[model samples]
Structures are given as structure tokens and as C-alpha cells.
Target: MSAALPALTAPTGRRVRVLPGVYAPQHDTHLLLRALAREAIRPGADVIDLGTGSGLLAVAAARRGANVTAVDVARRAVLTARLNALIARRRVAVHRGDLAAPVPGRTYDLVISNPPYVPSPHGPPPRRGSARAWDAGPDGRAVVDRICEAAPSLLRAGGVLLMVHSGLCGTEKTLRRLAEHGLSATVSDVAHVPFGPVVLSRMSWLHGRDLLDRRADREELVVVRAEQR
Candidate 1:
């Protein structure tokens, strides 16, 4: 018999297989952390990565000399993140819980996440593929809004928060929600990539509202940076 695969090891020292819809060590997570690392990340800064599916971003922050906490709702995700952290020889607290609830008695200097932000159809929820990773509930803002709502309490004054999601959820709504939560938010980046066919439904809604004047930017990923006020 042939030798077994390396079990989908973590990239950059953190790895986790089985993220429900996608394979482990998610790509967007790596990208998000890469962007954050490019900024001025302070040594020993406390950082938290919500929805840390594969521990990619959490490990990156730890490698950057920040004390990091990565949380996920799935038990598999939590265990995987912890294992990846160990393999990387980095210290990280991996918690199994939803959103910011797992973390208590602490605040972070940086909070980053790549949450489920895609709007799903009105019927029975998707049964597979990035569906678990992509579904953001109803209008796709459910989880995102919760994260924004909790950030002010979880972040230190002037702490930075970064998130990545698509434009279909109304980027302005995200910014407005951040402001409501006392965090100054702005669009930092947008990229064009295939959002998969499931997102086409959102296009119809946009088109109906005369929003079709703007191009179909499946790649229109938004990176919002918020500073706790």
C-alpha cells in the first residue's frame, strides 16, 4: 500500500484539516494574516482571531511575537489550532466556542477574522462546500454584526480590528455597524476573485435595485480596519 498523506498539515506551522466546506489551513486566512503582518505589529501584543477555522492567522500572529488567542466553534477546529500551534513551537490559546464568548477576562490589542459573510438563500441552508464557511445568515451580516458588536468590549482602547468578507452584504452596513460599536472603520482593500456560483443569487438582488450599474465584482472582497474609539 502507498504511504499515507501528511494529513493536510498546517501551512506556516499551523495546520488543520476538515473545515467543513473547504480543506484545512484556509487560504483567505493566510492572506488576511499576511496583510496584518505587513502592518506595524507590536511584540507581545495580545491578538485574537475569531472564527479561526484552521489556526492560520492565529499562528501567524504568534510567530510575529504577539501573544495570540484563536477561537472557533467547532471542536475539530479548536483541537486542530492547538495542535498546529504546538507543531509551530508557538504559544497560542485555542478555545472552542462561538464568536467572542469563549474568551473571558481579557482584551486584545488586535482582533482579526475571516468570518462567514455570504448571504444564503431563503430555503433550507446549504448542505456542503464553503457553505459552512460562507453562510453569514439571512443577509450575510449576522455573524459579522455580532463580531462588530462585541469588538469594543474585547479590544483595548485604540486596538485594531481587521476583517475580510465580500461586498454583497453592503460594505456601508459593515462600516456603519462598526461606528455604532464605537470603532472607526474604513475599507482598506478590495480584490476580484471567483466567489463561486452560489453567490449569483445575490447578483439578482443587486440588479433589481439598480445596483447593477456597478460591475459584478465577485472579487470585491472588503478588508475593514477598525480602531477602537
Candidate 2:
């Protein structure tokens, strides 16, 4: 069974952005942040926040005395996150690139992510716009799969990866993928959140694809924590 975490006080809104395309914090964001809170981060630990939308995770890590590097694929997200870090007075190194590609040859003690996992009937992620923040390709594992594939390389010998995604995208698949990549993984946190506008709009398609049940109006999100030993 997945564990539970306390809710946090920070803000959340996937498409609610200060910049045109930068995704604001959302429920999943808060979920991951709460999971990060439960971790006993060592002082000066190396930390990387993948898809650091508003630099919330990075700033939080920095506040905890961890050296933080935030990465995002969207330029606007990078700018907004940097602005957030600046305004918050937290020193965070922000980068722009797809998933984990930006930080090569560097390993982190803790890698955190709240990635795009909404299952889209459409082909691929959008070329632009706020939709880029939530639209994952069919089955919603596009970015999550990339993160799993990158975890073994990005994590130190005993480093940890904390990632959150919707239940519509197979939580078991995530756990198994991480294990296949040699990380001891488990569901560390879980919460049931109502379907957002995007998911609700795609309800018929979701049901047709068997990704969601007809009567289910809510989706369960799981936070998978994987540790390389």
C-alpha cells in the first residue's frame, strides 16, 4: 500500500502561471513537496529538481541547506523559476532542457520531480503553450519513463528519486520500471485528487482507453521514491 503525507501550505496551479507558459504549482506539486518534507536531507547534500516549474522544490531544498539545481524544458518556466528563487532569496541554479538531459556527468544525492503525466488522446506534447505543462503522450508515461531511465545515471550510489504522477498512468509501471533500472522503489505517498479541467475534458477518451473507470471522477496520485543502493 502507498503511504500518506500531510498537505503543505504553498500554492498550486498547473497552468496558473506568472509567465505565459510557465506552469504554476499544482496539487501534484504540493504532493511532491509534502513528500520531500518527510525526507531527512543531509546538510549540503546535492539536490536536483527536475521540471522545477516555479522553483518551489528547489527553493525548499535550498532552504534546507541542500545545494539545489532546477531544470525545466520550457524557457518561460526557467525564467519564472529563476524569478521565484530570486524573489524568495534562495540560491538555485536553473537550467533548461528536456527532462534530465541538461545536467550530464553530474549526480545528485536527491532528485525530485513533479512531471507531466496527464494521459492525452492527442499524439505528443504540445509544441507550445501552457498545455505543455500537463500533456503527456498516450498513456502519460512519456516524461515519467524518461525520468526513470535517467535516474540510474543522475543519482549517486545511495541517492534517492522522488517523483509524482497521476494514477491514470499506471503507478505499478513506475515502480517496476525503477526496479528494472536497479533502484529499490516503493510508493511513498498517495492522495486522491479530483480530475482537473484537462482530465475532465478528456473523460470520454480516458474511459475508452480504459485508463479511467466510467464512474470514477477522481484519480489517485502516487509518489514513488526510489533509492539506488
Tell me, by TM-score, which candidate is best: 2
Q: How do the residues 109-152 of candidate 2 rate in per-residue lDDT, one tens digit apiece?
A: 99999888999988898877788789999999988999999999
lDDT of each: 0.74, 0.85
The 10-residue segment of model 2 with minimum total lDDT is: 1-10
Candidate 1 global TM-score: 0.82
Q: What's the C-alpha lDDT at position 38 in model 1? A: 66
